[model samples]
Target chain A: MKKLTTPLKVEDLKDLKAGDNVTITGYIYTARDAAHKRLVELLEEGKELPIDLEGAIIYYVGPTPAREGEPIGSAGPTTSYRMDSYTPQLLDQGLLGMIGKGKRSQEVKDKIVEKGAVYFAAIGGAAALIKKAIKSAEIVAYEDLGAEAIRKIYVEDFPVTVVNDAHGNDLYQSGRKEYLQWLKEN
Target chain B: MRQIDAGLITESVKKMVMEANYFLPEDVYSTIKEAQDKEEWQLASDILDKILQNADIAKNDQVPMCQDTGMAVVFVEMGQEVSIVNGYIEDAINQGIREGYEEGYLRKSVVGDPLNRVNTKDNTPGIIHYSIVPGDKLKITVAPKGFGSENMSRLKMLKPAEGLEGVKDFVLETVELAGPNPCPPIVVGVGIGGTMEKAAFLAKKSLMRSFDSYNENPFYADLEKELLEKINELGIGPQGFGGKTTALRVFIEYYPTHIAGLPVAVNIQCHAARHKEVVL
Candidate 1:
């Protein structure tokens, strides 16, 4: 397993390969469908974004409200493809990585390669376990969006697997292929 | 005739909703444990372990097992000999969901309007299905459905000539296309031999059944086993990492259909399969 800290740089992602397990620490921002739409709209309107894009890793999630004394409720990655339309634009703004589940569109994969960004997959539906890694979470923007609101969260040892790396390798493709090959041989 | 209090229904539903969200049903939890034990792929096995751990945490901490506590889908079997007093059945059920979501700290995932996309905020107005059964008792099952798997569900109307092979093909295709999106190891719900909507409903209701149970019909039971094997053969594994356990079970629910059409619906349920019921 590889260990990474957020505010990630291109150099930090250069050596990563598809299928490598990763545990990320430091701070990451949360944004889902509605928040991504708003972020891209602000970029198009030439307004300053509420959060910095440079070296930032966006976690696609919409957590349940935190119970009293809890930092956040069950927090897990949402499906990534819904945000595909706005992802390239975010990458253009120097977004370094995305943490979500499921496969990304080819266009998003191409942009990840072009922009030296990475894509990571958190185990979907493993929310309760994943929430233990989050040390603190506070809504940073669009509170009206409720759970879809953008939150900046501090995490320690947040487990993820490298799905798409800067070199354009995709684990979803290669991993499935390898498994099928094993099935054939066995 | 027995008169049931609407308030009582509301209270029961409220508790059921919270329990459904916070607890992973035993059949699903055990099947996942079994899958983890059998999974040979290192990555797939680890992912399954995390899923099991998440369920344990959710149960112990009394938090939702998944962040998408889901749009509440309630199934009601009301006895024809019983009448609800004090309030309308629908209103009482909605009230129960609203209170449960608030009290449980479950995410309210419903929208007031699909196009306008405004949060309902209370998770009220659950999609309710009602049937009149024989006795004077009322039964309610609350199955909160997360959209990650819901989005991957599909329905198709096939020509009668296409037959059973066509149904099998479509089920495989839907799971293959869904890939990792629905969060395997998924429970495959197949609804066949109904109208378009009925097929869809059967597929969904099938998900409420326990993973270890099979369709009563021996033919369909064998078909369920066949489909489950084929799906795992696709190597979607747990979270699509690829392995022997892409699907924990396949359920088929069928009804008599018109002579001209065979409608099939595939409802995929993620490993966080949750449903709770109460009888009154």
Candidate 2:
């Protein structure tokens, strides 16, 4: 598996391709549907974003409350498509990576290519296992949103797969085709 | 006739919700393992392993299997001969869910209003379905319904002329459109016949049944097998990573409907298929 650290550069993501298993360390900002809307609203109002996005990676998640003595609860990736409408704007803001599960819209994929960003798929329903990689988490903004609030999370060796890459490789397409071909031949 | 306290109902719901969210039932666990063994793709295998590992962690840690522990869906079979003393029965169920979510640290996912978009905060007002049945016993089952797959669910009002093949096709279409989104190796709940809403209810209810459970009618049972095979062949696989196992099971529940209407609803449940029961 490839390893990457946060505040990722264009060069860091440009070489990544779909289907590569990656271990990403460093900070990934957590934002789901509500936080995305608020972030864009800040931009519209000519205000500073809650967190700097320059070469930043964002993870789409809404975690359960942190139980006593734990950094966080089952903190798995939520479906990513809900952020599509607000995505290109985030990409434009120098966002370099997105960690979540599921297919990206064609529009978002195009922007990922344009922005030299990568979309990584974490295992859905594997929250507890995923939480093992998260070392710390704290709400960064939009606290009223509860679980959906923005949080800055520190991760170590967080597992993800490249679903869409800078060079326009899509694992969901090629992986399925390759698997079907293997199924047919074997 | 025997009577039970509404507080007892509340207690049952609390236990059911906690246990169900914390543990992956054996059927789901084993099915995932079996699929992992047969998976041809390396990624699919790895994903399944992680899922199994997550379940283990949740069980051992007493934490939820998924972060979106989901909105509590309580299915009640209340005896007609018994009455719930002290508070209303619905209130009791909601209270149970309130305490369960609060104490367990399961995320309170319910929103107060769809448009206004306020978090209900305590996960109150569970989606409850109640049926009046024969004796003094009350059976409560809590299935935490995550919106990831619930949002992918669909209902179609097919004409009688469309027949059985149409029902199968609609379900397949829904799964295909859902693609990798519902976190596959999904459990497909197919509700056939009845009016529109009843069909939808049955679709959701079918999800609570055991994965190994089959329709008593031989024809429907065979159809279930056939549908499962076809879905697996789609290569959507686990988490839509593509493999030979797209679905773990397909369940169908039917009710008599008006001659003019042939409604079918497909309720998709993710691999997290969590549920538990308490009989009081």
Candidate 3:
């Protein structure tokens, strides 16, 4: 239940360990498969990204529609593995964190260790709960992509678990392997 | 013949869509909560805690349960005695889905072409299955199916001699192949009998059943119990962290198949398992 309330800067990520549980507050950017493609292209061409990448956390989500009187609709994390191809590129640019579910590629893990970056997984399919932490949201870019459009979201104490760390440790595999071994023995 | 109003049907369907996306269904919520209480593995328990937290966040904030809100899948049961008053039943249902996705602020996930990959903005042209049964009411079950579990679904056709043992082996192997990728503590819907497609349909449709409810047929009920025990034996656990509850429940739906074939389909559902039922 470690709470992180302040707006995190890129340098602040140096303090986060691989297994530490964190609650991220302040402005984070939303990008899914499509947005990631565009962002990576921009980086390849040596062009500036739409937002400052340094110390920023990226959440992989598309979200359902919002009903009346709601700030955002069912907003939950998508699988992070889908974006593994583009993640290292972003990480190279000082991108400090990522939020989603499931495993990552070896290349991305290497980048996380090479750079002082962290990866966190918000609960999948808990969009409504995640939305409460979002104080405000605005489409930052790629409006034509419909739900896949890039948006910047502001939040207070958005919760996540560090699935991968700067040291290249992964919780998902370790957790699964331990259980499988235990099952074989018992 | 009894005539059903298209407008009224659209309205109810629209609400169902919104409800399915907005509120996490009670049975699913309770099951996850129950898993948290019963999970033996620490990692599994921790994953369950995160899922519960996700549920809380979605309910309190009106956010979606997952990012891949899923392509719109609707099962429509039309009474044999009924006819639509205004438009075709499929059109009306698609209209309701469009309205629901738009008004509810949910994701529009349908694509017009698979290879070319063009987005169908409204999430329209839903995957609608229509079946005519006894009475006059039209029933719709909306499932916001995420791709993670959907990707893991499998169907196999076996020689009639293969029997239940073959079915059991295939079902277990399917889950084993899926591993933690589909997100564990999966709800496995096993559909046996009928043609290849029907078995697959029954498998997907079986997922609509309540998590804890037993199948109506006694033999099938027993089968559900046995399969559930074996699935848990896999130790895939919560989110594949490994635990006693590899699967929360096993639901079986079967019909008489051709004597020559034993068709079986296993539709996997992650813990999120968002689905809703409505009658219009």
Best by DockQ: 1
Quote fnat for model 1: 0.80
Per-residue accuracy of model 3 over A67-161 as CA lDDT, tens digit each: 66655665777777789999988887878888887668888888987886778877655566677777777898998887788888888888787
- Model 2 - which docking category? high
- DockQ of every candidate: 0.87, 0.85, 0.45
TM-score of chain A of each: 0.98, 0.98, 0.88
- Superposition error at A153 for model 2 (Å): 1.0
Error of 2 at A106 (Å): 1.0
List where candidate 2 sits over 4 angstroms from the true fold.
none
**Candidate structures ordered by DockQ, highest first:** 1, 2, 3
Model 1 achieves a DockQ score of 0.87
**Distance from true position, residue A47, model 2, in Å?**
1.8
Per-residue lDDT for B166-211 in model 1, tens only? 9999999999999989888899899998799999999999999987
Off by over 4 Å in 1: none
Better of 2 and 3 by TM-score: 2
Which of 1 and 3 is ahead in lDDT? 1
Q: Can you give the lDDT of residue B278 in candidate 1? A: 89
Candidate 1: lDDT of A91? 96
